[model samples]
Target chain A: MMKQKNVNKRHLRNDILLIIVLLLVAATGAAYLFLFRGFGDVVKVTVDGELYGVYSLSQDRTEDISTGEDGRQLNRLVIREGKAFIQTATCPDGICAAHRAIFRNGESIVCLPHGVVVTVTTAQTQGEPDVVV
Target chain B: MRNKSKTTAFMGLFTALALILAYVEVLLPPLFASLPGIKMGLPNIILVFLLYRRSACSAIVVSLLRIALVTMLFGNVMALLYSLAGGILSLVVMILLRRWNVLSTVGVSVAGGVAHNVGQILMAMLLLETAELGFYLVVLTVAGTLAGVFVGLCGSALIRKIPANFLFLDK
Candidate 1:
């Protein structure tokens, strides 16, 4: 009985350790994502594992991105005031639409049902075409 | 009347319970719409119970059955893919933790939740082919841990109420 009790104590202690380890890892990642993140120069959209297009953040415009086999207009990605947001999407969940405007490097909005991803990237350079206009 | 029938019945009951929970989870508005990975993990309670009482193989079978039934009934094919990935990953983590015996039920469940999120995100990355999307991992992990604690408590409480001889895990 004494050995059993000792073993129980060790298990409980390890459980606490597991929780700490997970939270610690999360905090470290959060620091990188929120604090150390840099402002991105372009918004890159991907559809079905292919690069749909790259839009410069300096330009302001609305783009209708069509998806699925029928090529129906599914998601609308808008870039304005140097920020990008999913203005609209035909997905049932609307998760991308609800996502906040993103402008930092490594920030992105993913629409799972529609297989769309809009990511802010550091690829901005002077020679880039002004695609918005 | 034999041992085989008893195990089958137990697995069936657990599978049904898990499916009901999955359905209810879908009916409820997702808690975190901002990120796709946030889940209450209510069905995990059943999985945890199975892992603790029954063999790991039985637990995995029950978990997969629940996902299949839930997806067939209320979700699409893609949803099934995501659930299968998440369910298997979570089951593996929980079983490993249980085997180590270094953590209690709550710890095992917490690990399960985090693994579930990781697995689903991996499936998304594979489907979408965008590696950059993993940036949201931190947020998803945090939400998963919070949900895990709640589900783990429920599982531990339920385990206490259920009879030890119920699963017939031992010969």
Candidate 2:
């Protein structure tokens, strides 16, 4: 009986620790979602080494990028002068629509089904195409 | 050896539960326009419960079978791959942590959630053929943390209410 009690105590302690850790992780995630909004500010898109589209986040305009053999699928990207966002896509997951306008460095847009990427680069950094799809 | 029939029955039941959870989550509305891959991961509750009561091998088998069967029912092969990768990674992490005895079912579930996000991101990187997608890892991981906790809590509750002995009796 004593041994069983000790085991139960250990399990309880472990459970508490687990809850604490999970709370920490969830809190950190919430913080990131709230705090990390405007960290970058440039919009550039390249396809197969060719400059397909570029938008300034500061301006309010939308550009349509159609990629595929005959343009059967449409990938619409919105650029508000300095900010870039994916407005829509024909992909099944519609993942591209979830990306917000990125005007800062290290921010990007990826359409896996369509094989396209749009990235923001820092002004000070050399403009090498970050990704080609 | 005599318990093999019982084990099979338990596995079938868990598999059904997982499939139901997966279907339910699919019905939930998307959280945001900017978070397409995000999900509540309700099925993970069942996975976590299985992990604690059954052997690691059983947990892995269940995870794999659940993904395959659920995907087939939904007709989404891509989603299946993503789930499989994430599930396997989480299972490995939980199994390893189980050795230290520091992690409860919830902790292991959270770890598994993080692993799943990592696995999905890796697959995205590969499929898209671009390292630029790596930036999304941070967001996915952060989301994973929340999802993991929710699933972990659910798993803890489930384990308590339905004793493992009853569930694994057939096994």
Candidate 3:
């Protein structure tokens, strides 16, 4: 019984150690990513893994992005005052629509159901004509 | 022979309980509006319980059954893909960690939770063909770890209530 109690204590220590290690790893990765990212110059949108369009952040416009069959799916991306956000979406969950405006490099609004990803980027994205309007 | 039947009955009961938990999660709104797939992982309590009490095989069985049923009831084909990836990956990690015997149930569950998120992110990257989604793992790791700790605590509490002898014959 004494040995069993000792083993349990060791197990608890290991558990706490494991949690700390994993959390530290995650925190490190987050810090690295957060530090490297900067203010973006354009908003890039992709639908179902394909490039849909790229709009300059300086442009102020509401783009009706349609996807799926007969353009049945839609996500309205609005870029205003150098910030980009989804104003509305036909996606069931509306997760992307609820996302706050993103202006930092690598920041994104993802719509899983619709397979839409709107990302803010500083680098030039290859694909589709850049819509500067 | 009776013992075999008892195990099967218990498995069924646990599966049902996990399904109920999954349904409950569906009813709850998204925990974080921006993070689409970060679940409370209520079903994980049952997974952890089965892992510690019965056998890894039983835990896998229950996990797969829960995912299959949830997909039919509350999700689509895409959802199935994500769940399948996450569930199997997490279970594999949990089983391996449990074998090491160095950590408690909470630690095993925490590993499982993190693995689940990592697996799902991998699947998302494959499906979307964009590595950018990898960034989500940072946030998901934190969420998964917390969920794992919660589920692990619950599983430990449950195990305390009914020791292995109450339900199973000694191997």
The candidate that achieves the highest DockQ relative to the unseen native structure: 1
Per-residue lDDT, model 1, residue A108, is 91
Fnat scores for every prediction: 0.82, 0.38, 0.60
Cα error, candidate 3, residue B28 (Å): 2.9
Off by over 4 Å in 3: A123-133, B1-4, B33-36, B168-171
Summarize candidate 3's per-residue lDDT along B31-134 as a digit string, tens digits.
Answer: 88766667889999998988887789889999999999999987898889999999999999999989989889999899999999999989888887777864
lDDT of 1 by residue, B57-124 (tens): 87889888888888778779888898889888889889988997888888899999999999998999
Q: Per-candidate interface C-alpha RMSD?
A: 1.8, 4.6, 1.9
**How do the predictions measure up, each by TM-score?**
0.91, 0.79, 0.92
In terms of lDDT, the poorest run of 10 residues in model 1 chain B is: B30-39
TM-score attained by model 1:
0.91
Can you list each candidate's DockQ?
Answer: 0.70, 0.34, 0.62
Give the higher-TM-score candidate: 1 or 2.
1
Candidate 2 DockQ category?
A: acceptable
- Give the winner by TM-score: 3
TM-scores, chain A, per candidate: 0.85, 0.58, 0.87
Error of 1 at B161 (Å): 2.0
Better of 2 and 3 by DockQ: 3
* Model 3 Cα lDDT, one tens digit per residue, A25-133: 9999787777877678888888878888888888799999999889989999999999999999998767788888888788788887888888888645543444533
lDDT scores in order: 0.84, 0.72, 0.86
